[model samples]
Target chain A: MIYVKELCKTFRVARRDGGMKNTLKSFFHREYTEIHALDHLNFTIGEGEMVGYIGPNGAGKSSTVKVLSGILVPDSGICTVGGRVPWKERTAHVAQIGVVFGQRSQLWWDVPVIDTFTLLRDIYSVPETIYRRNLDELTEMLGLSQLLRTPTRQLSLGQRMRCEIAASLIHDPKILFLDEPTIGLDAVSKIAVRDFIKARNRERGTTVILTTHDMQDIEALTERILLIGRGRILRDGSLDALKREYMTERHMTVLCAGLDADTLSLPAGMTLSESHPDRAVFSLDTTVLPVSDAIAAVSAQTDIYDLSVENPSLDTLITHLYKEYEVG
Target chain B: MKQFKKVPAHRLYGTFFSMHLRAAMEYKSSFLMSFFGMTLTSLASFFAIWLLFDRFHTVDGYTLSEVLLCYSVILMGFSVSEIFLRGFDTFAGQVQSGSFDRLLLRPRSLLFSVLVSRMEFARTGRFLQGILVTAYAVTHADIVWTPARAGAYLLMLLGCCVFFSSLLILQAGVCFFTIEGLEVMNIFSHGGKELGSYPLDIYGSRPLILFFTFLVPLACAQYYPFLYLTGRADCGLYALTPLWTLAFLLVCIGVWRIGVRKYQSTGS
Candidate 1:
């Protein structure tokens, strides 16, 4: 339920050389350099579709979220979230969206988390019955029942984050924009958050657009992925398709009786990546040679005691993608 | 789509007010210290004025009680505005910290949200002190209290609050462009309060009076209304001069709207 076309936002930043004289001169006559935070960015997200927005730092991810949430006005673009121009019809538009900036806490610092939720309830004008239902459901799902009465400052980071998420959802927004929601959470907390998000998407059909650096989050939660870099969308496809394209090379680790890497002659696509007296690791290009053929080829050299094959992890694949795209 | 009723503005404001109160109550000792500290600070300023009045029985042809009346009106107006309009007063911090973005994400008037986001209840110290001083001035100033005079007095208090509150809003609007609060803005908000403690005509300069009357409109809230209240100005229209502050408020809100539209939120 989101449409964006030719979205452009440029920021003018002051530039100066580092010196007292230069600082003084620049103070009098400053120069400005314009950075395009969003450059003709275009994307369309359908209702109830969970899409992962992946990008490196300063890649317009947060800028895109801000524009969608009505926090920033783009220089030139047409963006309508659920048929409302975000900046033009901000109040009406924002009412249908929930945003969580992981780095910022929306809950009041010294008060119980429930206080902020009630404040949000009033702020969004959520009906009493709906508010009660949402609050009860969120409290149960996020395991916030025990934490709601604690002051926000007294809670641990993970507890605070759960409360933050609940606060954003108090109005039952149709669209959810979560920017780095899993950042800094422990593994258990991350899993909890991801599970809740998945269940929410499944049960309520909430349109979820998440931007995160954690590749596992993308792998676990989203079906569709939008890879952004340098203020532009570089890739848009399903996660499985992206994995298939990048997962051509499989790592084969074989524990054998005798393996002499220097004396071994390998197939054209297979290279011995690591070697020991009884263990050898091979990087096999499965596109050129199948896993079974590589296993047969290695078995001929030595008696195999143990063997394991692994596709590259999402983190490595993403790094490879970033390098290929020349983006950070 | 589920139909949602709009929450009244007063209810939203009450929620914010109670939230802030609860948050403040968490640090009870700190709140008490600051509350009393604020009262003592304003009381010291009033004591200084009392000393000055004792030394010079009549400065600028105005009696001690008349000066006290002017001072208390400005004091009450400024403190009351400071108590409620603290959100605008400290808006630069919100903009810098990205909390203003959170406000925009809500379905409410931006101005009203900013107005209620913060309430410096500690300033009630200054407010109560102002009330006491006004009680003293009202008894001693010897003004014949006609209904019109009473109405003008109430209007003066309201105009003073609006006048300072508008200045705070104007300063907040400037924060959108600068990203930091300018200390120079204090000259108008704080300095105007100090200068307005006495009637504008007592400044004894036509240019200064004209500046306050036309530019800042502080004289409209304070001087002209006081003149009508004290029977010094026979024109009934002087009582209506406080209405000029309303126009100033409108202008300030216009500037704020422009600032919001021009706002490029800080980087996340």
Candidate 2:
């Protein structure tokens, strides 16, 4: 549904010293430094794919989203979504895509949330029947019935987020670009939003590209991730594949009915670190021994009450990805 | 898709405006007080001119009634422009506050969204005051109003409105590039009204041409058309000089388009 090739965006930034002399000099002649916000970025997302757009701060995540949604024109690139060049055919392209910038609101502050939706309905020229169907489904799924009557300024952050999601989808857009959609929400609201997104992907086949720092959101919603750094795509694969490849360590905790002992046998690359009377912890290097092999070896020697093994977290995986790429 | 159905853009604007009005009404005491306060300020502007005429009986041989004719049109046009186009005037704040991004993402034209999303209802009181002043001017000015003359006067009013609105649009378009929209834009918005309230001819040849051609097209919308209205100009087509106001509007829009293209490159 989306194809980006060698997409480059560069910004001309003014450069000046901090003190007074340079500030006055800047008024007469500005020295500009060119920063390439995006450099030869390449990615393609298929229709109905729920892709996680992962990156650190200033990693061009928002810039990529802006380009795809037809908000910004890249300096040089070929980006086509659904057979249309986004920036060139902005109105037509934007009609098929929905964007939610979690940092910003698209709703009118003083009006009831529903009124803003009504305005959006006219804006996209959504048919009456289609609008009602979408509104009904969203109101039910997102628990937006209560929010519709409240003016947006009066709504809580979570409530406003739910309404923003509804407002974005009023036209039944084919693709949804969510930029940190669950930011600042309580756990309940976060799960509610996550579940609603999953349901929308499943039921409506809406292709979702979600950019977020919250790893749990990635874990819960996306299987495929586009790991980006320094305006470049470092890895594009299934989340499981990433965890298996770069997830070098596994943590295991053992709870025993008896006293913790030093007699436990560990494989060559694994070591036991902490021990209490009835519990022990092991840090196993997955590169040297697979998690299953470590588990098998540990189970054989222990009179264990219970043992739990944990994979490297998505956060660690991402951190390593950034380090591995040395994205700057 | 749906045969390009007539979008309810205007009706939506009405709904948005009324909602904004309701919010304004929540501070009912302030809303009412500001409504009167605006009219009083516009009255002060007229009194400034009236007092000037008191000292000098006539300006460059133009009588008080003739001056009022020029003065009333300036007041009405400026008030109308400020009432409807205040968003553009204050768009630098919108850019700083990140609300301009909201306009960008909406499926409407950016210009229309900014124009329709907000209005100053308090300034509409200034418009009413301008009309009252114009009524006083129209009755006192001893001029024979032929049907064509009346039409020219109406056209001049509309042309002035268009001229000033175009200036605001140009100012907003430039804001998208600079991030800090120039405050110098206010000089044209306010100064045009102050200067256009008198005869442009009194301001010397260069000032007359500058006002006729650029900055605000005040001469096209007021001076030349008023001359024809007052029988000071013999050519009937002089009455049609108000149409030049439209060319000024077009040029402003063209400049705005260039600024918008620069904005696309900068993405601010």
Per-residue CA lDDT of model 1 for A267-328, tens digit only, reads: 88999888888998999988899999999998998899999999989989989999999998
lDDT of 1 by residue, B152-247 (tens): 988999899889999999999887777788888899888988998888888789999999899999999999999998899989899988889999
Q: Among all windows of ten consecutive residues in candidate 2 chain B, which has the lowest summed lDDT?
A: B1-10
Which parts of model 1 are misplaced by more than 4 Å? B264-268
Q: Pick the candidate with the highest TM-score.
A: 1
Candidate 1 is graded, for docking, as: medium
TM-score of chain A of each: 0.98, 0.92
**CA-lDDT, candidates in order:** 0.90, 0.84
Pairs with backbone N, CA or C atoms under 3 Å apart (clashes), candidate 2: none
Report each candidate's C-alpha RMSD, comma-separated, in the order given: 1.4, 2.6
